[model samples]
Target chain A: MEILIYLTQQFINGIQLGAVYALIALGYTMVYGVLRMINFAHGDIFMLGAFISYYGITKFNLPFPILILSTSLLTAVIAILIEKIAYKPLRNAPKISLLITAVGVSLFLEYTLSLNAFFTPNYIGFPRPFEIRSYDIGMFSINNIHLIIFSVTIISLALLYLLIYKSKYGIAMRAASHDLEITRLMGIRTDNIISFTFGIGGALAGIGGLLYSMAYPQINVFMGIMPGIKSFIAAVLGGIGIIHGAVLGGFIIGISEVFVSAFLSSTYRDGVIFIILFIFLLFRPNGIFGKNIEKV
Target chain B: MRFFLELRKLIFLALFIYLIIKLVIFSGLPTDYMIQITLYSFIIVLSSLGLNVIYGFTGQFSLGHAAFYGIGAYTSAYLSKVLEIESYYGLIPVIFLAGIFTAFIAYIIGGPILRLKDDFLAIATLGFGILVRVILDNSDRISEVLGGSRGFVGINKITNLELSFFITVFFIIITKNLIDSRFGLFWRAIKNDELAASSIGVNTFIAKLIAFIYGCFLAGIAGGLYAHLYTFLHPSNFDILKSIDFLIIVIIGGMGSISGTIIAGLFWVFFIEGLRIILPSEILEYRWVLIPIILILIMMIRPYGLMVKKEGY
Candidate 1:
């Protein structure tokens, strides 16, 4: 009975972690779907989201709804600007050039934020938006923070599904992802669609960042790197361009990480994640839902 | 007679070496610091050259070059300490052995990883890099001398200006000769288009594997030199950021250009170290900000790199 309760508690913890990863993974997948390029800076945007929230709470002391809206909007705008300034000129360049530029932008964000005036290179304790309260359910207990994470993830996922499936912009986004040049020839304004993709992706990462800091309660400039790479792996594991695959990959990664840290030594946690990635890459490079496209 | 036939090229190389020795060693310009920078520049040149082979010539994007470097450093450091080598002469053989060991490890991992393409290959190599770092962080559990996160110290300082200079020049010559060989042709073909190269019966996989192994071997040699030069090894020194630094060197130098690699490697080292002398301690962190901005701007302005023509190789 004790073991069962422990397992359930770990399971809930995994789900909460998975929720944040899924949010980040969605951004990665959507960007890859349209651009076919990994937005390495996406993770830094998530970090920025966390910082913005931290400042919003400590500096402005804004209401919860206003804080969330402003953080998402600010991140979305910054992402669009990044796409315009850094990525737009190199649209026709080689893929490697794009990758390098993304890495550069990522570094730029990290270091610029690390400046003494902005935020020192040290880790800062994240301010919680609300008080935490735990409620007992039979033999197990659950926290309100967990409930917040679950509800937020579900709401975001449902809204994203609606935005992608039911909206005209979503249809255009799908069309853009299918073939950018062809969709452009059909007068779809691919630039806007691409910008929109980055915006939505950045906004999602922002929300994920906010929720992640709430769970972990520590924010640092380099915090985004690990989760970013892990979420990217999640996106790749679920099939690079697939939406649902990212969610599935995120949950699997989150659960496996939790279980490994719980059972094995915590030092092996990162090693095990990469090992899982290697196994998956070896057996199913295209991911579970991905179609094998032979490049001629 | 064959040497006579190459008299002009040989004379130019000797003159270049003489100039470097004169400018750095006997010019009365603070021998210790100058020699240190010169030796470090050679180390960077060798490692960047290795990356140039993989990414520049063979078109393989590896984000794990530093892992091989770290492996070589740790392996050689451990071997030397364990064997209790007293003299620098004894360290020479250990360095080569370290390079060979790194190549062996590369050969093992390259077989499976080389099968992956583009971004998949990048991620796989990155995974390996991170895995190596994690193991290195816990390496104290394996042995007492192989310090974990705290760092590895007390290694012999065997690397000198003469040794580093000679080894660097030798490897540079070897790299140049290799680039002019049949294998170099195979690498170029594979880089241009693997499918086309394979369709022409070029054995693209074997060619890529060779490039990957050789590149890693060079990285190992550089790492060995680095271990003796600094006499200290830290896990953070071999992280993803260091790998990216190599990538930046290769890209800025122009892929597949040996002279460019050498020049850019020296420039990169001097530029960063020069900043130490020029900038105030309070604002030193801004260099990181400036570097990335320059990188992004360079990509925008000259995507093919500074050395390569717009038409590209």
Candidate 2:
């Protein structure tokens, strides 16, 4: 019974972690769907989101809902600007060039934020918006933060699904991903669609950043790198351009990471996750849901 | 007749050697700092040159070059410490052995990873790089002297200006010769188009594997030199940022141009170190901020690279 409770607790913890990964992975997948390029800066955007919310709370003393909304919007705008300045010029260049530029953008965000005037390089304790409370149900204990994270993720995913599947902009986005030139010829502004994709992706990562910091209660300039890379792996694992795949990949990665750290030594946690990626890639190079396209 | 015809080339080579010897060994520089920087520049050039072979020539994008470098450093450091080799002559063979060992490891990992294309290849190599770092972080569990995270100290600083200079020059010449050979043709073909290269019986996979291994071998050699140069080894020294630094050097230097690699390698080292001297300590961190902006601007202005023409060298 004790073992069962412990396992259940760990599973719940995994799901909470998975929720954050899914949020971040959404940004990577959505951007890749349209741009066909990995936005390496997305992770840094997530970090920015965390820092923004930190200031929003500590400085402005805004309530939770407004704080979340403002941070997400601001991050989305920053991301759109980033796409315009850093990415748009290189649209016709080689894919490798785009990748390098993305890396440059990432470094720019990280170091610029690291300046002492901005957020110092040192780790800062994240300010929680509300008091934490825990409840027990049948040998399981759950915290308020966990519940909030779960509800927020579900609500956001539902809204995202509606935005992508039902809205006209979403239709244009799908069209753009399918064939950008054709979509452009059909009178849809492909550039705006691409920018919108980056915006929405940035907003999701912002929410992810908030939830992640709340869970861990620590914020640092370099915090986004690990989670960002892991979420990217999640996006890849689910199939680079697939939406559902990102969510599935997130759960798998999050659960596996949690379980490994819990059962094995925590030191092997990162190593095991990478090993899983390697072995999985060896078997299914395109990822679980990724379709193989032949290059002529 | 052949000697007479190549007399100018021989003379230029002699002059180059003389310049390096003078700059590295005999120069009464303001400090040992200048000499160290020169030697470090050679090490960076050698490693970045290796990256030029993989990404520049063969068109494989690896984000894990530093992992192989760390491997070489750790391997050499451990071997030398265990053997108690105090002399520079004794360390030379160990350095080669380290490079060979790194190549052997690359050969093992390259078989599966080289099969991946573009972004997938990048991520896989990145995964391998991170995995290596994790292993290094916990290496002391395997052996305390390995010094997992605190850092591997007590290393002998035997890498002199002359040793680094000669090794770098030798490898540059060797790399040049390799580029001029038939394998260079294979590498160029593979880089241009793998499908077409394979159609023409280029054995693209084997060619890529060879480039990957050889590139990693160079990185290993550079790492061995680096271990002895600083007399310390830390996991952070071989992290992803260091790998990106090599990438930046390769891109700025022009992917396939050897001379460009050398010039850009020197420029990159000097640029950062020069910034340290120019910028006040209070604003030293701004250099990192400035560098990325320059990188983005460079990519925007000259996507193919600063030194290379559109048709490639």
TM-score of chain A of each: 0.97, 0.97
Q: State the TM-score of candidate 1 restricted to chain B.
A: 0.94
Q: In model 1, what is the error at residue B260, expressed in angstroms?
A: 0.4
DockQ-based class of model 1: medium
Query: What DockQ, between 0 and 1, does each candidate earn?
Result: 0.65, 0.68
Q: What is the per-residue lDDT of model 2 for residues A97-131, given as tens digits with 9 covering 90 to 100? A: 89999999999999988899888899999989989
lDDT of 2 by residue, B261-305 (tens): 999999999887756656787788788898888888878888767
Q: Pairs clashing in candidate 2?
A: none
Worst 10 residues of 1 chain B by lDDT: B2-11
- Quote the lDDT for B186 in model 2: 94
Worst 10 residues of 1 chain A by lDDT: A287-296
